[model samples]
Target: MAAVSVKASKGWQKPPTRLYEDNYGFGINFYQPMIDYLDAKEEKRAPKEYPHLPWSNERGLERYSSKKLVKAYSEKDLRRLVEARTKADHGAFTLTKPKTHLSLTETTSAVSAINRKGSTKEEVRVKKMSDDVFDDNMEQLASALRSAKAYAIGKSAKAIESHLLAESLRNLSSNTEVDIRSFQRRAEVSSHDSREHEWFMEQRKMKEEELEQLTQPLDQLKVELLGKQTSIEIEQLNSRVVEAETRLKTEVTRIKKKLHIQITELEMSLDVANKNNIELQKTIKKQSLTLTELQAHYDEVQRQLQVTLDQYGIAQRRLQSLTAEVEEIRGNYEQALRIKKSVEIQLEESVSRINELTVINVNLSSSKSKIEQELSVLASDYDEVTRELRVSDERFQRVQVELKHTVEVLHEEQERIVKIDAIKKSLEIEVKNLSVRLEEVEANAIVGGKRIISKLESRVSREVVSKTKISIPYSLKVSEEKYRHPPRWRNWSTC
Candidate 1:
C-alpha cells in the first residue's frame, strides 16, 4: 500500500523526496510535505519503494544488470575497478612538461577529497530535507540491511530474494532523517556516524581542492628551476657565439691579407710611376736646353745675314764708283789707239824699204848653201872637235831626263809644303782671333767690362769664322783634307 501511494503521487517533486529516499545520490532535495508522508509510511506494516542506490535500477538490473553489481561484485572488486580507472585515465602523465605535473596535483587533490570524514550524527538526523526531494544514499544503505534477515525466512528462494530486496529497500528509505520512524524503530545504524561521514566527505573535497591549489605554486617553482638549469638553449647559444667568433677571425685575417697585398701593389706602382716621372723630367730638361741652343744659332745666323746684306750694299756702291772710273779710262784708251794708228802708218812706209832688203837676204841664203860646203871642207880640218861635240849632245839628253825626274820630285815636295803652309796660316788666323778674344775676355772678367768684351769678341769671332773656309776653284777641288787642316773652336767640339 505504501509503495502504491508513492508511485501514484502526481505532485511529488524530484531529488531527496520525489520517489523514495535512497535516490538522493543524484542530489538531496528536501520536501517538507513529502517528509510528512514518508514519516507516515514509516509506521506502516507494508513494503515501500526506495529510488536512489549504489546499485539500484529496475530496468538497468534487467538489462545491463545493476543486480549483477549487487550479487556478483564485491566491495574489494569495486575498489580495484576505481583504482584501475584512475591509473588508466592518467596513463600518459609524465613529469617532463609543467602541465603534466599540474594535472597530477589535481588528481591527487581529487583522491585526497574522497578520503574525507562523513557528517555528524545529530546533524544528519535534524537535517531538513528539501520540500521537493527525491532520494539520498545514506538513507538507502541502512534500509537494505534492516530487512535482509527478515525476508530470508518462510519463503521460496526466489520469493525470499524479492522480499528481502523489497524489505531492504524499505529500510534504506526510512533511515533518512526525512522520516525518522522507518528504520529507527529497530536499526543497527546511528544518526551520529551518518552525519559525520557526510561532513567528512565535504571536508575531504575542500582539502582536495586546497591540495590542487597548493600544487600550482610547486609547478611554478619547477618551471623556474628548469629555466635556471643548463640545457639545449645555453649550449646552442654558446655554439653560435663560437661560430661567430671564428667567422670574425677569418674575416679579420682576410682583410689583413687584402690590405697587405694592396699595400705592396701600391708601393710597386708608385715606384714605377716615380721613375717614369724622373725620366720624363730629364728628357724635358734636355729638350729645353736644345731648344735654347737652336734659338741662339738662329740669332747668330740672323745677325750674320744682316751683316752680309750691309756688306753687299757697300759692295754695290763700290761697283758704281769703279764703273765711273772705267768710263774715264775708256776715253784715254781711245786717244791712245788713235795715236798708235798714226804710228802704224809711218812704220808701214819704213817696212816697205825693209822688204827690198828681205829679197836680197833670200839670194844671200842660196849662196849660203855653197858657203856651208866650203865650211864643211874647212871643218874637215876640225874632225876631233866634231866627234867631241856628238858625245856632249848624248850627255845633254841624259841630263834632260835627270832634270825631269828632279822636277817631279820638287812638285810632290811643293804640294806637301803647301798643305803645311795652309794649316799654319789657318792656325795663325784662328790664334790671332782667339788671342784678341782672350784679351777681351780677360778685360770682361774685370768689373764693368763684361758687356764690352762680349760684343767685341763676338764681332771678331764672326770675322774669323768667315775667313776660316778658303773657297777653292772647281779645278782645285780637293779631298776633305783642306777642311780637316782648318782650326776648330773649343766650343764647336763641345757642340
Candidate 2:
C-alpha cells in the first residue's frame, strides 16, 4: 500500500535534490534504532584522545598533525622506524588487523587488574562473611525458641497460682482488709485475661468468615469462565460454518456464470451457422440460374449452326447439278466446233454460234469452283461449332457435378443444423431444470443465524437471481471487417 501511495504521489517522478544527498534518507529507515544505539555508545565514551590526529580527513596527514606530537615522535624517531618496518613487512602495508600487542596493552592490563583486585576479594569476603553469619543466626534462633518456651510456661504457672489464691480468699469472705485487697487484684487480672482471650477468638472467627466470603466470588468467576469458553467455541464453529457456506455460495455462482456463458456462445454459433446456410443457398441459386441461361444460349447457337450447315449442303448439291449441265453443254459445243473447224472458211454464222457456247461453258465452270470453296468453308465452320458444342456439354456436366457436390454439402449442413436445434431444445430444458434447482437450493439455504437454527418455524426464502437468455448474432463477414479471423476479443451479449 505504501508503494502504491508513493507511485500515486506527484513527487515520485522527480525526487528532491536532498533525497540523493542524504545517505540515510534512501532505502529502509529501520536502521534508526541501530544509529541511535551507536550514538549512545559514542556518548558513553571519552572525548577524542587525539584531537589533532586528522580526525575526519586523511589527506596531507603531516600538515594536520600537532607540532608537539610530531616533535615527540620525530625526536624519538618512532614514526620513521614504524614506516620502515611497515614497508619491510608485506602484511603491514595494509592494516587488515590491528597490532593486538600495541593497541590493547593498557586496556588488557587495566581489565585484568580490576578483575583480580575487585571481583576476587569481594567474592571471597562476601562468601566467608555470609557463611559465618548464617551459622551463628541458626544457633541464636534455637536459643531464642528455648527461652520463649520457658517464659511462657512460667507465666502460665504464675497466673494459675494467682487464680487459685483468689478463689480461696473469696470462699473465706469477711476476712482482714489486706487479704481482701490482694484477692481483688488477683481476680481483676484473671478476668482481664479471660476477656482478651474471648475477644481474640471472636476476631479469628470473623477473619475466617471474611476469607470464605472473599473466596465465594472466585467460584462464581470460575463458572463464568466455563460459560465464556463454551460461548467462544460456539462462536468459532459458527464463523467456520459461515465461511464454508459463503465459499460454497461463491462457487455455485461461478459455475452458474460459466454455464451461462457457454450457453450464450453456443447460441451465437447457431445463429452464425444459420446465416451462413442462407447465404450459401442464395449463392447456389444464383449460380444455377446463370448456368441454365448459358446452356440455353449455347443450344440456340448450335441450332443456328446446324441451319447454316444445311444451307451449305444444298448449295453444294446445286453446284453439282450445274456442273453436270455445263459438262453436257461443253461436249455439244466441242462437237459443233470440230465440225465448224472443217468448214471454217465456208460459213461466218457457225463461227459466231461456237463463240457464244464457249463463253457460256467458262461462266458455268467458275461458278461451280466458287460453290465448292464455299462448301469447304461451311464444313470447317460446322466442325468448329460441333467442337464448341462438345466443350459446352462438358462444361455443363462439370457444372452439374459441382452443383451435386454443393447440394450434398447443403444437405449435410442442414442435418447438422437440425441436430444442433434438437440439442438446443434439450439444453433449454436442462437449463430450466437447473434454474429450478438453483431456486430450490436458495430457498433451502439456512439464514437468520443461530436463533433460526433452534426453531422449526417456516421462514421466507430469499429470491434467486435467474439467468435470462440472450440472443447474440454472429456474422463472419462483419466480424472479419471489424476484428478479422481469430478474434482478439470476446464478443458478449447483455443478459
Candidate 3:
C-alpha cells in the first residue's frame, strides 16, 4: 500500500491537507487520495448492484440480460451525477505526481504529499479502498450513466414520432369521414330526385287521360251542333213561304210605295250581307294563318324534343363508359387490397421470425454466423416490405383522393340530371297546356262558325220573304209550294 496526501489551499489561510492509504493495492497509495476524492465527490454512492427482483430472481440471469447489464437510476442520483460532471467540465482537473515515495504498507505507508507553502498539519482521514477495483467500478458507473441518458433521449424521439404518426392518421380518418358523409348526401339527393321524377310521370299520365276525356266530349258536341244547324236551316226554308204571304196581305194598299221602300231596304241589306261575307272571309283567312303558324310551332317543338332525345342518348353512352371505368378501378382496388393483406401477413411473420432469431442467437454460438446471415436477410426483407407498405399507403391515399374527386363529379352530374329532369317535366307540362289551349280554341272557332251560319240563314230567309212580298205573282203560289219541299240534298257546296 502507498500513502497519498491531498492538500486544499485557501488564498489567505494555511493550507488544509488530507492523507489516504491504499489497503489492498500493489503500492498504489500514490493515487489513493484521488480515489478518495472521487468517492467523496460522488456522495458516498455504493457500487451499483442489479436489483434482485422476484421476476429476475426466478430466471436468475438470462444470458442476454447478463451480457447487457444496466444500472438502475434514481432522479437524485442522476442530478448529483450531472452536478459533478458540470463541476468537472467547468474546471481544470489534473493529477500531480506525488514526491517522496519508497516503501508502502497498510500500517506504515510512504507519505507522498502535494507541495504547499505555509501548510499546517491538520489531520484528515480517508476511507480505505481497493484502488484497482474502485477505478474499474467508477468507469462502469460512468458508462452506465451515459447509456441511460442516450436511451431516454431515444425514447423521447420515438414518442414524438409516434405522436406525429397518430395525428396524421387522425386527420386522414376525419377526411375520409367527411367524404363518406358527402357520398351519403349525394345518394339521398339522387333518391329524392328519382321520387320526384316518378311523381311527375304519374301527373303527366293523369293529364293525358284527362285531355283524352275532354277531347271526346268536344268531338261529340261539334257533331251534334252541326246536325242542329242543318235542321234549323230546313225549318227556316219551310217557314219562308208563310212569312212572305203574311207580308203581301198586310201591305196591299200602299204596294207601289212599299215596293220602292222595300227595294231600297233590300239593296241595303244585300250590301250589308256582302260586307259581312267579306268580313267572314277575312276572319277565316286569319284563322287559317293561325292554324299554319301553330303547325310550324308544333314542328319546331318536335325538333327540339328530338334534339333532347339525342342528347339524352349521348349522356347514357357517357354514363355507361363511366360505369365501366369505375368497375375497372374497383377491380384494381380489390387487387391492391389483396396485396396489402399479404404484405401485412408477411410483416407479422417477419416479426415472429425476428423474435425467434433473438432467442436462437443467444443459445447457439456455433450457428451464430449462420443466424447473423439469416437475420441480415430478414432485415433486408423487412426493409423491402416496409418500403412496399409505404408505397401501398401512398397509393391508398391517392386512391382516396381520386375517389373523393369522382364522388364530387358524380354529385355534380346527379345535380345536372335532376335539373334536366325538372326542365323536361316543365316542358312536357307546357306542351300539354299548349295542346289543351289549341283544342279549346278550335272548339270555340267551330262554335262561332255555327252561330254566324245561323244568323246568315235567318237574314237570307227574311230577305227572300221581303223580295217575294214586293213581287207577288201568279207563279208565287207554285213557287211557295215547291219551296215547302226542299231538295233531297240542299247543295251546301253552292250555298
lDDT of 1 by residue, 1-62 (tens): 01222443567576333353333322222233355556657856323664333333333333
Off by over 4 Å in 3: 1-283, 359-495
Q: Which ten-residue region of model 3 has the weakest summed lDDT? A: 94-103
TM-score, prediction 3: 0.18
lDDT of 3 by residue, 428-495 (tens): 45435534543453354345434444554565456564654434442444344336434311221111
Candidate achieving higher lDDT, 1 or 2: 1
Question: RMSD per prediction, one decimal?
Answer: 47.6, 57.8, 76.9
The C-alpha TM-scores of every prediction are 0.16, 0.14, 0.18
- In candidate 3, the residue pairs with backbone N, CA or C atoms under 3 Å apart (3 or more residues apart, or in different chains) clash, namely 2-29
- Per-residue lDDT over 1-495 for candidate 2, one digit per residue giving the tens place of the 0 to 100 score: 012222336656675333233233221133443555566568674344422323344422544323212123542265446445444433211221123322121323333364343356534543443333333333333443344334434243334334333433332232223223433333344355777446545644663475355445533543454345434534554565466668878998999999999999999999998999999999999989998998999899999999999999999999999999999999977765664453333224323433443343344335324432332322323333334334434543453354355336435534554243444454345435544543442233212112232221121111111111111121222333334312211110000
lDDT of the candidates, in the order given: 0.44, 0.43, 0.45
Better of 1 and 3 by TM-score: 3
RMSD from true fold, candidate 2: 57.8
Ranking according to TM-score, highest score first: 3, 1, 2
Candidates ranked by lDDT, best first?
3, 1, 2
Best by TM-score: 3
lDDT of 1 at 183: 25
